[model samples]
Target: MPEATEDLARRGDRAFLAIGIAVALWLVATVIVLPIVMPDGPSQAVTDYLGALRDGDVDAAYDAAGAERHDADAYDTSFLRSEALSTDWRIQSVWTSDDLSPYDAKLTGGIEPEGHETQPGVRVVNAVISHGDATSRGQFYVQETGSRDFILNPFVYADAGATLGFVDLNGVTSPAHRADNGDKLTKKDSFALFPGFYRLYQHNDDLFRADPSTLMVLPGTDVDISTSLSLTDKGNKAAAKAVRAQLDTCEKSTQLAPSDCPFNPLDDGAADSVDAYDHEYRDVKDIKWKVLVAPKFDIEPRDGEGPGDFELVPRNYATIRLTAVGVDIYSDSDKAKRFSTVCPIDPEDLVLTVTASKSFTVSGPAHTYAGRACGRDH
Candidate 1:
């Protein structure tokens, strides 16, 4: 009877061991193997979306997030696929709608979602994405199409506006247009962009420059980045050169009042009698003009204008000496005499327009005496 009891006890031990092994096998399959084979959850959807961006795979990122691509000709997408967007990024944590706060869940109200609707099986995934020293917390809506498969909704885009007419994204010239926010249109020129790190600048750095601004785009949030452009050192130098060249062209003219020239010998009252000078000085042989002091001026950007628009504001008057060999009509002498006169030119603001090829066109100031002749020597 004792030997029978020992056999039963051994059999019982073997049965317990077999049951323990079965449980261990089940746990392994449930914990590790099933996750690999089954469809991804909401957290994985968010992870994949961010991962695609970090890899500089813009198409993959947009596909993973189910976001529609804007018309390539209409929107600027060069920065989204450039190397500037490739940065070290990681996902800190992801939470579902139940774990989010009321304010967090409603973050999508500002930006219009692509095609997502609040319904059953729709889950909002909140993730914390970290890049370098910056951390962005964003929310994404995912809908369950299958039992375990979740499709991430579209992400948010940004509109970049500039005080200048146009703005550059990562050194590419992007033409700006009026932004349509689904309700109304904006007054400023806007460029549609994807969610990523962008460098806001101007490609025409020789004429103008802005402080390089770093724009971080987050999900479910619309960003408007505005930058102010000012003239650069090179621009000032170019303006000075243009002003001097214009003045030189004016000096070459033999007329006392050159067309479109800031300096003129005839004042407003005497301007009408200028035509009589040529008849009066018909006996005179040659007329010469010499600039005494060059005009002193400063360059400034035109207010409420494009990047290429500028003005040369005069700081001081320019003195010009006119010399001629003519009969002195005041003395009633027909004999030729050397006549000399000095006129101080009050230079007005000169409009400077720069072209895309960096060529400068300087338009002289408007004067009352333009095209009028200088009367006989006073």
Candidate 2:
């Protein structure tokens, strides 16, 4: 054999020897060193707790941490909401330290908030809790009786109470669940919810339903859900019907005064003469009405009781527009067939203040939105 060949073989043998040593070291570390140095118990406890939560065994998870201040009802409702709204959480990392308690470990996971499905990585504190018994101290995400859970704090900003109960699209009411230990009614705002998806309706059939609207309750913020209600399709329909009823009274009027009809555009002098021409507002088209229901009870400074009794009366504003197909101005007084040009009654838009509650009742004199009459007026 050549000396060069022998030298190459010796080098290869040394390399193999180095690789073997490295493997041996790794084995030693995996079998002995890791066990001795890394505190797996804490990490394991965290895993067990997370598993319990994932399985909806909240009590088990709390028991694992020896949690004393466990409000099962509140926690259960909140957890259920979280689970329903959120996607599967993936464990990012699990770290343990000897300097910390044997049960102390830090865990990280990725989660996405409800509506934001495309994005992820909302980190929560999944740390191995070092409270209560030494054996269970390794448990993760546990809280004392009075203490708030870190995970829950981020999800629910405030316990909101609605003056009027809200019904979902399915007609499910807001106070969805009530538990002995965790009655949602006892909470402020009647709901402990963070801003997310909700469909709400007023109890009054006359009022509109808010369908699949996002209830914007910011985390760590308080809001009255009722203050921001909008008109539903049903509401718009009702409003249009009511306006047509009012128009019917106007259509059949002859005197053009309050006795005959509450709404008279001629009274405002916008029209030269409604009685002179035959005004037929059949199939009231392009009808637009939006009702904004606001907080009504006036906090008046009256001396009777301590800050006065709450008058159920609330005030709301209604914006309305009505357009007619034709307003016939005739040579003869008879409305039957004088044969005048078909004049379009442009949209008469009016904002009326109404004394409103569950239903909007026009408070003062009725408002009439009428376009131009035939004559140019002297």
Candidate 3:
């Protein structure tokens, strides 16, 4: 009897082991093999769409990626026929999740504005693409003064919490404009300067978009955003030589000659991205000369408080009337002037006259560009 009981128990254990192994094999096949074989939702669709786009079937490609682009509302197929679809732009990746269908790609990242002309060097992106492959390498004929991982933008010299209201450095002062003798914002101005946190904040409707239209003042010049950029890859001495040569041999008759001066015309007319310019600061084409509205506010004093209780604050509002007298910032890469030899403070834009009912910190001290480039309470 005991021997019979032992045989039965062994049989039951063997049956249990067999059932466990079968279940394990079935799970493995379902989890791993099925994903490899199946082409459903965004995955299968994204692959087909990318292939169609490459094959020049834009109609079919758009149909596939129609849901992913912001230009869908235009109702115009002709717009899609431009550069991003035809030339210089190509797909890098297309991701389709259960909820999102993102078309990722790299554009022939233009070294000039409008992203028209392509540069050399490859940069990758995982975001939704509407233009070209975001991974295309870039080789800029004219190296810009910034770093670009996915987005290309140049920066201006501004202290953190910097205000860029109009300032007259040519000895003329106005309520709308301040006078800095020679103060310069020391920050390297461009989205590419710090690519890590800056890019992630720029995505998803670009809620944290930083304005590239800011103007910077040269240290000591006191003029706002008026420094010229040098194009030649030579040091200070060599660049000075090149600029002198360029200024001498160039004919006045050439269309691009007179207009290419460091002091740009109000109607700035220059063409072709030279080593003397930035990709973002593309002359007067991308820039507009409009008035700024700077508003003012006052702090209310307490009833029992003395005169010290009253505080004067410039309300964060708007400023109007400051005009774009001239664009002094062109590429100084030819090395016309050293980056900055004088103090960053614009002596001309300094506090010429402060008229207020309440007294405050009257004038700032002489600032140097040698140290931190932030504001000196301007």
Candidate that scores best on lDDT: 1
lDDT of 1 at 145: 67
lDDT tens per residue, model 3, 1-378:
699999999999999999999999999988986746554333334445545644656566545533333332222121233122222234444432222111112111112333223432322112232232233222111122234122221111122222122211112211222124434422122111100001111121111112322222111111122212111222222323433343333222232212222222112233411112122122222222121332233332212212121222334532211111122355454322211011111211112111122111112222111221211111
- Order of models, best TM-score first: 1, 2, 3
Clashes within 3 Å, all models in order: 0, 9, 63
lDDT of 2 by residue, 1-378 (tens): 999999999999999999999999999888975645452444544455455544546456555534333332342233233333211232333444323212211121112233222222212233322112211111122222333222322223233222232223213344322222344444432344322333344344444433223343223234344433344556545544544455455444433222223334342343333422344322122222211222222211111121111112224331212223323443243333322222222212212211223433221233344433432211
Superposed model 2: Cα runs more than 4 Å off: 1-6, 22-50, 55-87, 90-158, 162-164, 167-173, 176-185, 188-378
Query: How well is each residue in 1-378 modelled by candidate 1, as lDDT tens digits?
Result: 699999999999999999999999999888986655443477677777777776778788777766556433234454445444635566667666764333333244234333445454566777777756877677776766665534433434445543343445556554444332333434223344444555665456777676545566656665665655567788778867887888888888776566656765453434322233444332444667788878898776665343335666778866766786666545566787666665665555356755545556777644554333443435
lDDT of 1 at 236: 77
- The lDDT of each candidate is 0.59, 0.34, 0.27
| Candidate 2 local lDDT, residue 165 | 26
TM-score of each: 0.53, 0.31, 0.22
Model with the higher TM-score, candidate 1 or 2:
1
Which is better, 1 or 3, measured by lDDT? 1
In candidate 2, clashing pairs total: 9
